[model samples]
Target: MNGRFVRLGETGRARVAIVIDGQAVDALEGDTLITAMLCSVRHVRQSEFGEEKRAGYCLMGACQDCWVWTDEGERLRACTTVVEPGMRILTTQPEAQWATLAL
Candidate 1:
């Protein structure tokens, strides 16, 4: 499930390190946050309700299914935000730390 979406004969884009939960993942330039995440991970976040893993439902920003947090705790919609180099991201809200710890 972790792979790049390369068009036939297309050259690779510049790689950037996008950190998720303190781990680094390679992402291509011009990739949205969700696209970059999808290249390395399966889910965008865990649901607060039941700790269910959630991926993006809407590629656009209208749906709230693809929200991710900055390391500083600010939330952003992953499908609309472009990935940047050295971005420290957290895949779930800080409140969801308990679910992660339980894993």
Candidate 2:
């Protein structure tokens, strides 16, 4: 799928591998998680309150709009967290995994 954000410049950075949901995505070496996510996906994450998707309100770490989780249930501030090679990100809350299992 096409992403919401397009890269107009800085195309020379090394690519890093990361998994979003279950799909493999390429991110820049020094990019923040939010930047990496928006580069390959339409939205940053699904809203916990409803079905609406979110793409982050604040680019900095001051807001809670960019919260995402790891496979291990660790919360991350996508806008402030740097993307790392082999990073596995879940746009949905990790607790949802348990909810699914319980169903």
Name the best candidate (by TM-score). Answer: 2
Residue 21 lDDT, candidate 2, scale 0-100: 93
Q: Clashing pairs in model 2?
A: none
**Backbone clashes under 3 angstroms, per model:** 0, 0
Task: Give the top-scoring candidate (lDDT).
Answer: 2
Estimate, for each residue in 49-95, the C-alpha lDDT of model 2 and write its tens digit.
88899999988988789999998889999999999999898888877
Give the residue spans of candidate 2 off by over 4 A.
none
lDDT of each: 0.81, 0.91
Q: Quote model 2's TM-score.
A: 0.95
lDDT of 1 by residue, 34-86 (tens): 88887787788888678698888978988899889997778989999999899
Candidate 1: segments with Cα more than 4 A from true spot: 1-11, 98-103
